[model samples]
Every structure is written in structure tokens, then in C-alpha cells.
Target: MRSEPTDAERALWKLLRAKRFSGYKFKRQVPIDRYIVDFICFNHRLIIEADGSQHAENAYDEARDSYLSQQNFRMLRFWNNDILTNTEGVSEAIWTALQDETSTPSPQPLSRKGRGALEGAHNG
Candidate 1:
């Protein structure tokens, strides 16, 4: 990860930091496995990414997302432009995702080995 955050990341961090967002704790530039996520809320198993044009249809990101999903992390990706311009809408979307718990299980950390074993058993 870069030492300096982009303008958009800085803006979003203001909204998410210090449990300011409805008491949900979020960490920035967090490492999960081999990938460094932009923002993450461990309590919700949620990962939020602020993407630039380079990330459009990115194969590496797709693969990374798949891997994280298998580990029970939900992804919410927003464009830098959108995050900067439509800040309220972006915040609303994140709030909706956080409140909608029916689709996701209670937050729990799963080790890589445990996730692989579960997938193997399911496939077998």
C-alpha cells in the first residue's frame, strides 16, 4: 500500500474513522491474507474499497475478491469520483449493508487453513 492515501481515501476515512459511523469500528489499509484492503470493519466482515480508473474490470481484484468472499468477507466497492462527489449516497449504501445482517452471518474471523478445509469438504 502507498504511504499516502489518495484524496478519496482521506475523505472516506473521515466518515468511517473513530467509530463515527453508527458505532462501527473501521480500520484503513488493513492486511487480510496477502491483500491490503482500503477499509475494513471486522465486526461486520465488510471490506470497502475506493477504486480509481485503473481498477475497472481488474482481474487481480476479481481474484482477490473471490478469495476474500470465500473467507466470508463482503465487499463494497466505490469509485473515487463517486466517493468524493456523492458522499451521502455512498455513506447510505454502506449503512444499508451494515444494517442488513440477514444475508451475512455474525462476524467471526476464519483462519486461511480453516477456510480451505471447509471449501475442500464442500467440494468433495
Candidate 2:
């Protein structure tokens, strides 16, 4: 539960929450340790960050991105204005990135079932 992200983050959240895009579940304001990310899809180890001008001066953010990359997470960052105005293009870019089979990161998130938890899901 993130303190409701910025306007730009909210806009993208609307498009990502509830598996709305390509049926992937993206969590908002997820805290991996001390930092909270705008969106994280653990299934694909994909992180979507919508950055504002302040991010330009945040050296800490750069360090975080590098750490995430080293942890096998693919970080996709979009400028706030770009995401707010060109949602379709943003979505397309995400789709295209996901479809890059040759460069797709491996060791995908394991299924809950593999760990003996069924997510309390009831099958019909």
C-alpha cells in the first residue's frame, strides 16, 4: 500500500492494476526493503518507474536502479509527462519490451504452487 503515487504513477497504475495489461499483476508502491517502487510485477521481475524532474537529481535512484538490474529485474522508466500524454505508446513500449524474447531476463518468478501455496485460489 503506497501512499498513492504521484499523478503520473496513478495513471499508469490504472492501466496496470488487476492484471489489466497482458494479464500481468502489477503491484503499486511496493517496498523491496527501504525503497518503494512505483510498480512491480514480480511474475516477470519487471519494474515500471514513472519519474518526474526530481528523479533527474536523485543519485540514489540511480543506485537503486543499478541494484535492481543486478538482481535480475528489468527496470523500465518513463518520464511523467510522456506517460500521462502517451499512455498507448507507453503501453506499446512495455509490450515491445516484454516481447523481446532474445533479451528477456531469465529465472522468472516461480509459481506459488511450486512453493505449496495456492494463493487461496479456488478453481471452478
Cα-based TM-score, every candidate: 0.82, 0.76
Clashing pairs in 1: none
**Could you give candidate 2's per-residue lDDT for residues 1-124 as a string of tens digits?**
5565788888998999898998988988888876677888887777777766666546687677766767777766777776777777778767765665335333222232321012211100
How far does residue 121 in candidate 2 sit from its true spot (Å)?
Answer: 35
Report the error of model 2 at residue 2, Å. Answer: 4.9
lDDT of 1 by residue, 45-108 (tens): 8888777767655678777887887888887777777778777777887887788655552323
lDDT of all predictions: 0.73, 0.66
TM-score of 2: 0.76
Name the regions of candidate 2 deviating beyond 4 angstroms.
Answer: 101-124
Q: Global CA lDDT of candidate 1, please?
A: 0.73
